[model samples]
Target: MTNDELQQLAAGLANCGKALLRMADVLMEKKEDAPAAAEQKEPEKKLTLEDVRRVAADKARQGHMEEVRQLIQKFGADKLSGVDAARYPAMMKELEAMGNDE
Candidate 1:
């Protein structure tokens, strides 16, 4: 092949390499973002009084009754039932964490 033809072919190949690299970068970015997008799309499970009660019961059974009562009182409730429904998620989180402390 002529020198000029070979140079032109080299430049074309380099351009194609750059294009491929850009495509790879885009695909990688999308892959990295996929999990975050999925997490954002997935709705948080709604916490219920019963769910909180179940966890609290487990903690109590494990002999954390006093700790459970303090956690409930921290939310300004004397008992689990007295705590507002809106606070169930936070209450459950604390109850679950109580077991992890061990």
Candidate 2:
């Protein structure tokens, strides 16, 4: 890539990183401010199966399964040990079914 093209790509990445950081900050603030948030949450009881399914589906729709799998592999199943990895069979099935759907 030309220097100008590389510079533009770098700038775009920086902007994206900044946006992600802003989102993280907002999440942190909410967690700190909401004392009852944890108690009121049902996911705490069993972890949100729907959220996991949605995340897998979203990643599949976005053609990012490889990235998602890589993240899981890197993080290890133990990292999310509370979650039942067996339940993800459906997510993977859905992801496979969505191959090239995008």
Candidate 3:
């Protein structure tokens, strides 16, 4: 409403803008230096299902029979009634097909 009041308001706004610009400059500087300032890191190696299968097969072929048995016990078998009698051969066939595919 008054010239002095408007000038005071403008001065306040200018101070806020300067503060925001300084904060932005500091943030930009940190971002620019972040990668080099931190460790040059290696990308992590991810183990896939195929990697696991290959490792298990290798271990099995090397006579890690108990390891193979444990893996089969852990993740291979479907938990169902009469699974051993009902699905064992089919499972064997599926495994054989998988081996053939490989």
Best by lDDT: 1
RMSD of each: 5.4, 22.2, 12.7
- Residue-by-residue lDDT tens digits, candidate 2, 1-102: 899999999999999999999999999999898987756756433325576657665875687767656545544553323346665554455455554554
The lDDT values for all models are: 0.90, 0.64, 0.60
Task: For candidate 2, give the lDDT of residue 77.
Answer: 51
Stretches off by above 4 angstroms in model 1 are 1-39
TM-score of each: 0.60, 0.35, 0.41
Between the candidate structures 1 and 2, which one is better when assessed by TM-score? 1
lDDT of 3 at 101: 38
Question: Going through the candidates in order, what is the number of backbone clashes in each?
Answer: 0, 0, 0
Cα displacement (Å) at residue 6, model 2: 0.1
Q: In angstroms, give how far residue 25 of model 3 lies from its true place.
A: 0.5
Candidate 2 — which residues are off by over 4 angstroms?
Answer: 36-102
List residue ranges in candidate 3 displaced over 4 A.
42-102
lDDT assessment of candidate 1: 0.90
The best-first sequence of candidates by TM-score reads 1, 3, 2
lDDT of 3 at 37: 65
How many backbone collisions does model 1 have? 0
